[model samples]
Target: MGEEEVSNKQIILKDYVHGFPKESDFLLKTSSTIKLKLPYDSHDAVLVKNLYLSCDPYMLNRMREADASYPTPFTPGSPINGYGVSRVVDSSHTSFSKGDLIWGITGWEEYSLITDTSLLFKIQDADLPLSYYTGLLGMPGMTAYAGFYEVCSPKKGETVFVSAASGAVGQLVGQFAKLMGCYVVGSAGSKDKVDLLINKFGFDAAFNYKEEEDLNAALKRYFPDGIDIYFENVGGKMLDAVLLNMRLRGRIAVCGMISQYNLEEHEGVSNLFCLVIKRIRMEGFVVPDYYHLYPKFLELVLPHIRDGKLTYVEDIAQGLESGPAALVGLFSGRNVGKQVVAVAHE
Candidate 1:
């Protein structure tokens, strides 16, 4: 089929976000035929057919205004952007070819012209599911690996606590901590997710935060001896509760704060004073800084995946039409695992 005959469907941002994003925040539109061939005159660009798009909590932050402290915001009336797996259809860059498979930042559309080819990573192994690049083998995977090993500095036999335990990065963090011989406990919003964390991801113990009236008491029950490492995903009350239960000289890896994301005023972490008394180390991290260790991460994780020692789950929403609902579902704890939008069949 000719490229001119292929139409592209796109999801464009409505405008800067206020409190929380709604389905109306995006508009689905179709574009004319895609250009199969890259213009020879153009430098360092590649055209790709998107296969899968990731729905992550951090993307919500990007929808806000670009403050001096925050990263750049998504442009109004433009295609909403996120990490996706794609097949290169046309290229003018030496690093990638026309048929190469890649994963990186791409617009929420059927086709994308990646102006910065350097951002794309070539897919060398397809033995694993290609859709994994949108989740476990992609951004969330790196986030789990870097935040756990790099920031948390876990030692075998240490007690670990992960909030939002059944979600993308949290699931993997629990598994990685388990494999490291740590006693891992996780907290989820519902019974189903808590069960998945304990039974599927091999967490030593799991709890439904919704069932607990006192989060601090729940944490105390989970880690009677105190937690050596805490993976912070849901912040606010959960974080404050975790602070009260943290062991002396403990480490806390701040991967995300889903609880505080939609709030008009950011919630205060009242127990931060525990850091001083306990001499604990709490650090916030972004995954990209440790991209250099991706190869090393693959070396460690791929074997576990191949041997069935590791398990990854995805809550995939088929078609671009489901994109808005899938993204919104994260806030309500509707998705059971790593929420993804399967935009097309590769």
Candidate 2:
């Protein structure tokens, strides 16, 4: 199939967006003329058939014009790119061979030639659902593990608070904290999500933040002694309240600010001064920095998955055509769990 042509259907960004992204911002186009294998002289490149594509919140930032912080924007006419689970069709790279199952950054198209394999993680166990590479077993898993174990540094019986607690990273963080013997409570967007956090993920308690009038009061009610660790997922108003509720010397790992991503003017966190007075340690982190811990993290997480101690939920949208709606659903809290776009199931 090296030289044979295949129609490549891609999700292309129409233009840079200003506010909340509509499905119309993306166009699904199919091209019959394409290369299905790594091109000649393509040093360290692998051609892959994408199986599952992750629809994450951060992808929204990439759709907008380049910012001072997020400088890399998706090319207007090109296929949008994000984390994906793929099966290698052909390779010029020594590290990867044809038929290898790998997960990393790839084009939103049906087939993608990945030039840089620096971030690619080989899928070893074929028994597990390959789609896990897009969520629990992939980037979001590493994020939850590192942010909770390495960054937060929890102790038994401590109080932990997680915002966006029912979503991918939040659910995993909540479960990890619970396993560490900490009292964990998560905040979700709806009653169903809140219930899933407590019943499914084994969170100590959960609440719908959308129903709360005062976030500060809500935090106070749950964490009477104040939160020892705050897994900051939703920034803006949530951050402001968490800053006020955080106990002295508490740690806040700022993984993302989904609330502020679509805004033209980012909302200010007014309680930042509390960090100084409270001796609280608040730092932002990107997941890629902790990729080195992948093997060890898997060792720690696998047993929990094997036994009944841990569970993960995913909202899968079938096919490349569903990419836009699936990705956009993340912002509005339409997705119940980890949002994954299934291209071709194995």
Candidate 3:
């Protein structure tokens, strides 16, 4: 037959944001249309129907002007893109075909035409929830795995601390530390999240950082002996406090600093001297650098998921229309778990 066409709805970035982001910072465009087939000359292109879009803290960096990063800045009038789970509707790539499920970096729209398929991963083990590919089994999962296991070099019986402990990445890190036989303590912004970290995730102890009058004292109370390993997710004040409480020769895995993302002038940590005095080893890592370990990570995690040894919580926004509000909510600690925007079911 003939080429099919359909109306494409998208969440577009209105402009570069200053300070905290708002729903109005993004525009929902519903008038666009796209062909459901690749161009005749299109080489290795994949046309996909986006099923779910991932709302991650890292996307905030992409909303700004282009930087020296894997994802460049989003164009002012174009669709805002991030990691997503999609079904292949059309493809010219050798490894993909119609009806196959895939997850990767995709546009924030009903449909997307992806030219670079290097980052795209064909979803295997369809028996699990497809939305898991947006967080638990996708980028965030890999991030938690890489940062905790490789960067932290965690040992059994060590005292571990995680900031933003109930977040997409931090929750998994705490569980992994528990699995390693470590004493894991987590810090969250709310009492509800603190309870989730302690009760649901099996963390040894958790505290509401928002309620803590003095963060340094709180860390001391949890880790009286000092922290052997720290999974740093929140930066600024928390990092400074953790620095003071770190054990000698401690290891710190520097993941995303969500606290500094929206600030015009990022908050400075005044505890660098702690690293020197404590002889601490601090390293910052990006997930893509460890993408090669995905297969190995799945080998270790999938069994735990099946056995109900690991738990993942997701906060899903209903539709493409909910994208802006959901994305903006990350900064305010409004989301309970991994934030996902459901664009379509299939």
Candidate 4:
């Protein structure tokens, strides 16, 4: 018997992106190969067969060459890296053994040999769909849970507003707020997504921000008494409007600024005075900063999912080939829900 060869399909970044990303900015290359075994430096490495790859807006920032912060930027000639769910085929790590289902930072290929086992979470409840790990149970789920309960300090009957309502985190936030007996409203880019917020996700009200000429007027229409909390996913103009409509001592949890990600010049927020006038508490957050809270989040959310008290909608594109389109689609509002690429099913 010889070492088995595996065809590694990858979505490679074409070049360092300057502005908005296009499908052409990536190449679906199948010229790579991998051996199905751990190397000598595999003290904590786990070889995994990737299943679902999450397409999140934060990935756009990673494509830039300027932001050289933690995790670094995605290189020009490497696979487009993101969070994914996978099954461990081989492991040299103590925490994970062979055949264990795990989810974390894996490459956009068929097989990923992960060196960073620190972030990988073992899937204890395999009864739930593995695809859920890429969206609902993974980073986005953690974002929604932490941003709403931990950050917002939500109380019963409080008015909460979410931007990008039909998105991965936004949908879950709305659901969580509803469970807390809070008045929840969300804004989406399209009427379809708006309807999903109200009809599907049980939001108190929802509106298409694209149709609203005056966002302030729209906010006033929905939150007549003003917003008690704002879960910010889309930024720029939407953020400005929410600032003006916030109640005194309102809390704001900023998880992302999808609207300003690819802009040549970022939009300046002119609502600083509104924050001062309202005495709103606005804070930006990164998901990795709160990974320690994953166990707590899972305990709170998993039961709701099993009992159907909470639901998740995913806009899945099939195969590694669909990876490029899915990644580019996040900024264009092309996906209806949480955009995911199903690399392989197992």
Candidate 3 Cα outliers beyond 4 Å, as residue runs? 67-71
Candidate 1 lDDT tens digits, 11-129: 88888888888888888887645666676687889888899999999888888887546556889888888899999988888898988999988889898888966557888888999
Q: Which is superior by lDDT, 1 or 2?
A: 2
Every candidate's lDDT: 0.89, 0.91, 0.93, 0.90
Which candidate leads the pack in lDDT? 3
Candidate 2 local lDDT, 1-346, one digit each (tens): 6688889899999999879999999999986346786667888989999999998888888989886576378999889999999999998888899999999999898888888789899998767788988989999999999999999999999999999888889999999998999999999999999989989999999989889999999999999899999999889999999999999999999889998887888898899999998999987888899999999998998888888687999999999999999998899999999999999876
- What would the per-residue lDDT of candidate 3 be over residues 1-346, giving only the tens digit for each residue? 3187799999999898777889999999999999998899988989999999999998888888765665577788889989999999999999999899999999999999999898899999888899999888999999999999999999999999999999999999999999999999999999899989988999999999989989999999999999999999889999999999999999999998999988988899999999999999999999999999999999999999999999999999999999999999998999999999999985
Model 4 residue 85 CA deviation (Å) reads 0.3
TM-score of 2: 0.98
Once all C-alphas are superposed, what RMSD does model 2 give against the true structure?
Answer: 1.1
Put down candidate 4 lDDT per residue, 1-346, tens digits, no spaces.
1157788898899898988899999998888888888876769899999999999988998889855575478989989788999999889999999999999999999999898788899999889988899888999999998888888899999999999999999999999999999999999999889889988899999999989999999999999999999999988999988888999999999989899998989999988798888888898888888889999988988999989989999999999898998889999999999999998887
Return the TM-score for each candidate structure.
Answer: 0.97, 0.98, 0.98, 0.98
Clashing pairs in 2: none
